[model samples]
Target: MGYVLRVRMASFFAGAATASCIGLSVLYKDYKTPHESISLQAKAFHDSLDTRISTLESLRQSEAPQLPQTTTD
Candidate 1:
């Protein structure tokens, strides 16, 4: 059998954020341009996407109907 790799997107995004913290720290410490503004835009975009994904999940759950369970003797 060949090698197989399985990746979870949530984990990937979380790893990206963790890695970015180190780089962002350095940039923030010495940033003198409009980097903060650009960063804010990027963060806002990410936040919106995360919120939408969560909202969709909640809506899906609420919309799905549950059937009554029948007990068998």
Candidate 2:
């Protein structure tokens, strides 16, 4: 009876260790970030280009001169 109890305990601990390892592997895979990092970099580049185009358009509008008014008395 004592030998049977010891064998049971060993099997229980081994199963627990295997479960813990599987849980850790799943957590590590879920928390990975490579694709998110690349997406953020691309978004930043697009925003910079948009700002540059807006600034150029604003400067052009400001530099253009207005035509003089003609007299029709």
Candidate 3:
């Protein structure tokens, strides 16, 4: 009975280790892709947004009305 229990425990540990390795490998593969990560996507979005904001700011500045100065006598 003791031998059987030891074998069962060993088998369980082996299975768990295998499952963990496979899961880690899958995760590594997924994270290896640039677009697969949320952080990368968020960074790309933030960069694009920054670009758009700068463009809009430049356009607004260009279109703004200039006030003329009056000379006092």
lDDT tens digits, residue span 4-73, model 2: 9999999999999999999999887766676677789999999999999999999999999988999999
Local error of candidate 2 at residue 25 (angstroms): 0.4
For model 2, what is the C-alpha lDDT against the true structure? Answer: 0.92
lDDT of each: 0.85, 0.92, 0.93
Query: Which residue pairs collide in model 2, if any?
Result: none
Between the candidate structures 1 and 3, which one is better when assessed by TM-score?
A: 3
- Which model, 1 or 2, shows the larger TM-score? 2
Where is model 2 poorest over a 10-residue stretch in terms of lDDT?
Answer: 29-38
Q: Report the candidate with higher lDDT, 1 versus 3.
A: 3
lDDT tens string, model 1, 1-73?
Answer: 1222234666778899999998899787777457777888999999999999999999999999998999999
TM-score of each: 0.46, 0.48, 0.51
Q: Please list the residue runs of candidate 2 whose C-alpha ends up more than 4 Å from where it truly belongs after superposition.
A: 33-73
**How would the candidate models be sorted by TM-score, starting from the highest?**
3, 2, 1
On lDDT, the candidate that comes out on top is 3
Better of 2 and 3 by lDDT: 3
Q: Count the backbone clashes (under 3 Å) in each candidate.
A: 0, 0, 0
By summed lDDT, the worst window of 10 consecutive residues in model 3 runs over 31-40
lDDT of 3 by residue, 1-73 (tens): 9999999999999999999999999988887775567777899999999999999999999999998989999
